[model samples]
Target: MPNIEQFTPTEAYEALREDETAALVDVRSRAEWTFVGLPDLAELGRDTILAEWRQFPGMTPNPSFLDDMTRQMGGTTPQTVLFICRSGARSQDAAIAVSQLMEEAGTPIRCINVAEGFEGDLDGSGKRGGLNGWKAANLPWKQS
Candidate 1:
């Protein structure tokens, strides 16, 4: 019965620093990662995870999301698979999907959904990344 945890950017960074085998999966779309940016988990000396959702524009749950996650996991053993998205919604879904996959395979991997994603809450102009996300936490990140 593996459960999920909510990790702040700083805590997540610290975990990555201590464990080289840990992975941070950015469930954000390619566009968001390109335009907004992503946390520099690699610079902190951990294996940065990558499994971008396969869709466009809106953050809709892809029916094959779990399949893709299984592919990404491949033969790797169950480790920390942190999921992050624009505002944490999609990441939660992703985490649940991944966790279910792991359970089905009897791996029981630990997965977490970042409470606030790359972009936090909506700003005055209804924008994100200004209130409570990775950017707001002042975590190391770079635009791609």
Candidate 2:
């Protein structure tokens, strides 16, 4: 089995609501977050952590990703962390990396890839956010 698990946006939202130790991490670039909007976790009394798995423009991997995650998580280490991006791919990579890191730290966590992500897959018109994502599912979200 892979180090990470996969869940649809609705499933992830439910898990986050049910599990107090569950948290979310958005791995899209800052530009994407600003332009495409962000997941709203305020209802859960939490805020989604923002960290780039890959930087904008060049799309280069962010060297400080793990560090940023650790810092953003602070003293409270969540038992479950859901990772989301524009689509599922990048979030999966982020989930795997974090899973490995947490296991190595002797604090194994359930790292989940929000499979459909915030924007989901492309539509017939070659666009996203309308098929099967967090936004499409009508989950809480907002623009920056």
Candidate 3:
């Protein structure tokens, strides 16, 4: 079994900025990406890959997640891929799946989950973004 690594949003951002072969994959739904905003990697000279881990509405798992990820790679395999979602759970699942697929393909890429994700966990007030997450950490992001 392949092991999945974890990184905080800030750490992931730093790693992506420092490593030329590293990429960030946002596994959130299309709706989330449009409404909740997205992590901006423009300054790093890299675009964040948008791949849905789950469909919107019912939140069903996306059947083409792996294929979508492959297509997003654009024929270039990254040495490291960091997955992020609304929170860490979905990204962890994405990381595990990608890790297994990469291992099977003998590519052995490092699949990392962005802990705290984009929105982080719900605070005592039952709201996100207030807790520790990419947005809360004051990282650059933009809405579309």
Best by lDDT: 2
Of 2 and 3, the candidate ahead on lDDT is 2
- Per-residue error at 136 for model 3, in Å? 0.3
Which lDDT tens digits does candidate 1 get at residues 25-81?
888777877888878865766444566665767656567666555566674754777
Candidate 2 TM-score, C-alpha based = 0.95
Please give the range of 10 consecutive residues that has the lowest summed lDDT in model 1. 45-54
- The global C-alpha lDDT for each of the candidates, from Candidate 1 onward, is 0.75, 0.91, 0.90
How would the candidate models be sorted by TM-score, starting from the highest?
3, 2, 1
- What ranking of all candidate models by lDDT puts the best one first? 2, 3, 1
Across 1-144, the per-residue lDDT of candidate 2 in tens digits comes to 456888999999999999977889999999999999999999999899998999999999999998887688895668888999988999999898888877888988888999999999999999999999999999999997
Per-residue lDDT for 48-122 in model 3, tens only? 899899999889999998888778789677889999998899999989888887888888888889989999999
Candidate 1 overall lDDT versus native: 0.75
